[model samples]
Target chain A: MLLLRIASTHVRNRLRQTIVSTLGVALGVGFSVAMASLMEGSQRDFMTTLIEAIPHVEILDEKRNPAEQPATALYDAVAFHGLRPLEDLRGIRNPTEAIASLREWIDGDFAQRLSGQSVLRYSGQDIGMTLVGVVPGRELKVSKIREDMRAGSFEALDATANGLVIGRKAAERLGAELGDTVTLTSANGIAKRFKIVGLFHTGITTSDEGLAYAPLKAVQILLEKPDIINSISVRLADINDATRIAARAERQLGYKAVSWEEANEGLMEAFVVRNAIMYTVVGAILVVAGFGIFNIVSTIVHEKARDIAILKSLGFPETDIQQIFVLEGLVIGVLGAIAGCGLGFGLSSYLATVKFEVTTDIEMTRLPIHFSYVHYVLACLLALFSSGIAGLIPARKAAKLNPVDIIRGAT
Target chain B: MIAAQPQTGTDTSPLLQTRKLTRILPAVVPVTLVQDVDFSVGTSEFVAITGPSGSGKSSLLYLLGLLDRPTSGEVLIEGCGTADLSSAEMASMRLAKIGFVFQFHFLLPEFTALENIMIPMQKLGRLSAHAQLEHATGLLVDLGLEDFLHRRPAQLSGGQRQRVAVARALANSPDLILADEPTGSLDSAATEQVFESLQAIVETQKTTVVAVTHDMDLAGRMQRRVHLVDGRIDYDRVQS
Candidate 1:
């Protein structure tokens, strides 16, 4: 109690220096928290876009490396190692069985899909496109295509024969619009004329410019592949269950089922790297604030030499003296942390309110910031720990001061 | 009557004693601050240590107060040798039995007069907070500082601040009070007032006093005087 009282008294006596030290710690915390909020908000935004725009789990046709064959050519042994082409591969062949099995094992929305590369011609403008056929009602449950549709409706595309739902960017490039007929030709010189029933925008340049959707029956007739499907898109109740369900589906259905996590590995890795850099930058700020605390505490010890001697002469042990300064440091740390958290919350909220234009499939008009108490708790702990250590160094110095030396000097 | 005699209470033991006590400041060139000095302070006796500047008068008082360690000799309080005691043990001994008052009136500038007096009691931790306040106020009132009990050192007069220091020294009610020029910074009138206050407390509390001062007149008023010259005792005189 006496040590705490003494420490507080010292802080009160030197108000300016105490405020400076407190602000030093506060600025560090505020910057760290603000940076964390921004980084976390952006990460959340990117992940939400990824998870909603793509299927949580997708079963695709598998291609593999062909078995190598050894041959003798001109007295030298040669090995041929090449990959098998997926064009010759057929569909899963038993689509009903695979779909039934997935439905039985996992609680999710499932849709059959057929995709191939083709070229679209509209008003003399040619664009290479990936043609996908989907059952609109089922596809809506697995992906955000329906939500991103800007004109007409998925039902119109699903009901009308030879109707194509085109990306908005592709329509813009080719001068195509709803109810306009476009020409689509397969690689084998087979062609068909389809009317654009709907246009969708996904905020992705490649997808918007080069993707089109048609009714499943029409695509099947055009490709000359009836009762066949290339893959199934699945959306689970919990996205985190994507990996488990995907592995189960792959093992039972005899196809490669890729989870969103696996599909976005590169993007996830980039986020990890970004977080590492952000934390390091924030941690450096906290450490700098710690140095500020150390400097102020050390100066206090240096200036209070006579007061220290007087206390020491009063039979206050060295340990008590050490505790006094350490307590001082802790006080500054906790106070700074609280203040910084307040500042960070206000700044983040204010940032969230400032509208900014970001390209998104959904209507978005502001920078996203996720408010989390976990960040504040961690920031407080870090600030306290750093400043506590800072206080210890100078506290030890003060404890080791020689009362006789100080008294003699003062006299 | 406070008369000085040679080992008055008991010939076999004195209240505080130092035998061949020597202190050297070790450095590139070692400086001997106090060399081969012998001294004793009996119960209820007031002794003055007087010498020129840098003659180690303060050094000798520091050794007696257990604030510093002797290089070669041993200091014994109540015949218990302090050479083997740990620093913590010596601190306890000082807290329980010895009190120190410096000439600069080294009251903590941030604390009030009563709170400054409460510091020693607080450190000892034997009294409750409420009781500590009562005792601190009582000490200040005894020293004629009741009206200025809540005043900080800066707000007090020179004599009032010195009186607060004396009150602080007596806070633990120790057996002996060590003053390194208690009135050195005071004017003549203030010096007499502080000296008289100290003399009254010693008489009333039966506390032994060992004060270091340069004023010969002040030294003459003590029951005995130990005069040092060049870190050695030049004279030990008693006024009977």
Candidate 2:
């Protein structure tokens, strides 16, 4: 109780310095919290877009390693790497059995795909593009492409014969509209005419200008690769369980299964680096505020030398003297943190309401400000930790002061 | 009052005793502040340490109060040797047994007169907060500071501040009050008021007072006077 009284008295004595130091901490915490929200808000926005645009897990007809030779498996041979083997067909052999088995155990939906490059011919203009053959019903469950359609519908692939859904930009380049017949040549020189059933604009320039979707049987017949699927895309109920389920599916199906995190490994690593930079900026801010606390606390210790001597003579221990000054620093830190939380709230709210002068089709117009109480808690903790360290340096100096020397000098 | 007082000496054990108490300031010349001094004060004795400027008078009182460690000697408190005690133990003993008054009022300027007196009692923690409040108020009232209960040191007069210091010194009812020129800066009228306050404490409260002073009249007023010259005892005699 006496310690608190002494601490408050010391802080109240230097009113202007206390306020300045407190304002420094307040600004540090406030900006850090707002910056944290901005950084994390955009991360969440990008992640949501990424998770919706791609499959959570994809099983592809690929090999992680060369198949074990018959001799090596049977005889434990070490130096028989030169053995030649026959090349097998490069696609999942029987997707029906695998898909049925996956459906019995998996919690979400799946989409079968056979994607290949093709050239579109219309008005004597040739535009190269990727054509993905998909089951219209299953593709709708696995992806959000249906929402990007400008005209027609993704389900029309099943409704019309020889139907195709191409990006609106790709169609515009060919002067082809919905219901227009466009001749497409496969990579192997096979050509077929497909009627445009839908048009989509995904806002991404590359996808909008160079992608199209068609019926599975039609593409298989055009590519002359019937009864073969190159990929099975799975969308799980709980996205976080994608990696584990991918591993399980790879083992059970003997296919190379990849999770979304593995597919976007570079983007995930970039997020980590960005987060590190954000926290360092926040910590630097708090450290600067800590220097403010250090300056004011050192001043208080210097000014209270006589009071310290008197307290020592009055039977206060060195620890008590140290505690008084340290508590004075904490008083400023706590008050600043509370005020900073209010400032952070105001700043975040303002950012949330702000809009951009240049608007995009799919990108957000206003600032994405993620509001989480964790940001306030983390900012407050950082302030306290920095202020604690700031207080300790001068508190040690005050504790070491010899009462006799101070009293003698002052008298 | 709780423990058996040490019986290291005669039946009438001196309240404070020093044997060969020397303090030397380590410097280029190794100046000796106090040298090989043997001193003792009996219980409830109002003593004066008289000497010229820089004669180590305040140095001796600091050594007795455990505020400064001696160079190569020991001080005894109630027949118990204090030389071997750690800094923490020394501070604990000083907190419970010794009080101090300096030439400057030395009250924490931030604290009121009542809070200033309550500091020692609060440190000792012998009484509840309520009782400490009552005791502090009583000490101030006895010092005739009843009218300035909440006045800070900056608000009080020089004489009133010194009396508040006296009240603070007597807060823990210590065995001895080590005063270094307590009234050195007070006016003649204020000096008399503090002088009577110290006398009332010594006689009525039975608390021993050992003051370092240059005022010959104040020295003469004390019951015993120990005069020092060049850090050595010149005379020790009772003043009639």
Candidate 3:
């Protein structure tokens, strides 16, 4: 209570100086909060872009081990795993059969679920139409695959017949669309005709401009490598747990598993570096606010020498005096934190509403500012704690004063 | 020459006693500001110590008031040795039993006259806030400062401020009141009024008063007067 009285007196006596100091602290907190919000928004945007570009996890072939030797390697390995090796692998005597076995497993167990699935057989000309060999209802889970369907409905691949799905960019390049027949030349120099059933446009440059889809069997037949697949993609229930799930999948399926982080390490690293730089800049602002608190509190102590002596003579303990100055600093910190929080949220919301044109080819043209509650709380706490620490020096000095000398005008 | 006659039928207990009190001034060669001072004030007695400037009269008063510790010897207030008391205890003792009135009227400038008087009582921590206020107001009225209770020290005249200081000194009903030239800063008329208030309080409350002063006339008017020279008692006398 006595501390409150002293703090009240301090503020009343030095209202102007206190206000200016508080504003300094508030600006520091405000700047930090704003920077944190911006960093958080940028990271969210980066993650969204990456997730849209690829499946959360991709399964690939494991490397062959040179130490292991077996007779009739491909056929024996595939038969041991209850799978059918592709015809191309059957011709190679003693070839590694693990890849063929993986292809057989996917064709037997997942083929019914692989809707809108595709394959593209390109010649040396760098142009080809999509051979989309999908089940009737399952390929929408792929990244950017469902969102790109612009023309005819997605195609279903029959066991014996071939169909194709091409993107708008490919249509523009080959003068083909739904119901147009296009010839696909494979790497083995085989020419096959496929009817384009759908044409889609995904905004992503890499996918929409070059991608083609067809059934796995049709692509294998066109490429003259029956029962072979290039890669297998998987989407999980929990996107964040993709890394752990991918590891489990690698152990279960005997194939190499890749997570989103491993696939886009460069992008994630850039986000991390950007966040670190932002925190350093904002932390510097908070440090400046701490210095402002120190300056203001010291000045208040210098000005209140006489008042302190009077209180001391009235038998107020040194701890009481220290608490008074500390409370004054606390008042400044709390008020500044509140003001900064309000200002930061208001500014972030206003900025979120303002349309910002981004000329990037891969993302939305206008980016909206994102706010995180955790970051806001952290910023306010940093400001409050820094101000409290700043008060210590002056509070200790105030506590150590000699009442007699002060009252005697020895100050 | 008047003979020294002791009090008649008074209590033998001394309210304040100092034995060979000394205060040293710090320097390359330390100067003995006040040395070998032996003094005691009995209950209900008013004693005055008179000396010229730089004669160490105020130094002796400060030592006796517990505002400063003596370099040598001891101060016993109400039969308790003060040398052994902790700083906090000494402050408490001063708050409970001793009152001080400085020549400069060291009342807080921000507080009103009533608030200044209420300080010592507040420090005692024995009375409730209401009781402390009541006691303070009663003391102010006794000192004839009721009219100026709301006025700050700066707003009041020199005499009124000093009277407020006296009222504050009497607030806790201290056994001893030490005044170091309490009226030194006031005009002649103001000084007379301040002295009248002090004398009236001392008489009515039977509070022992020990005053250090350069005013011989004021010293002569007290019941007992002691003259200090070069930190030693030169003469001691009592008036009829």
The lDDT of each candidate is 0.86, 0.90, 0.71
Question: Could you give candidate 1's fraction of true interface contacts?
Answer: 0.69
Flag clash pairs in model 2: none
**Whose TM-score is higher: candidate 1's or candidate 2's?**
2
Comparing 2 with 3 on TM-score, the higher-scoring candidate is 2
> Model 1's DockQ?
0.65
- In angstroms, the error of model 1 at A344 is 0.9
- All-Cα superposition RMSD per candidate: 5.1, 2.9, 7.7
Sort order, lDDT high to low: 2, 1, 3
- Across residues B1-240, which tens digit of lDDT does each residue of candidate 3 receive? 122222323356477877777788778999887888887878888889988777778778777877677787777776667776666676677777888787877786667888777766665778999998888888888777889889988998888888888887788888888887888888999889988877886788899899988788888899999888888888778886
* 1 versus 3: better TM-score goes to: 1
TM-score of each: 0.92, 0.96, 0.77
Q: Over 4 Å off in model 1, which ranges?
A: A63-88, A359-364, B1-13
Interface RMSD of 2: 0.9
DockQ of 2: 0.73
lDDT by residue (B1-240, candidate 1, tens digit) is: 112122323456788988888999999999999988888888889899999998899999999888898888878787777887777888888888898888999999999998898888988988999999999999888888889999999999999999999989998889999999999999999999889987987799999999999999999999999999889999999965
For candidate 3, lDDT tens digit of each residue in A255-307?
Answer: 56788878888877887898788878877888788888889899988978876
- Against the native complex, each candidate's DockQ, computed on alpha carbons, is 0.65, 0.73, 0.23
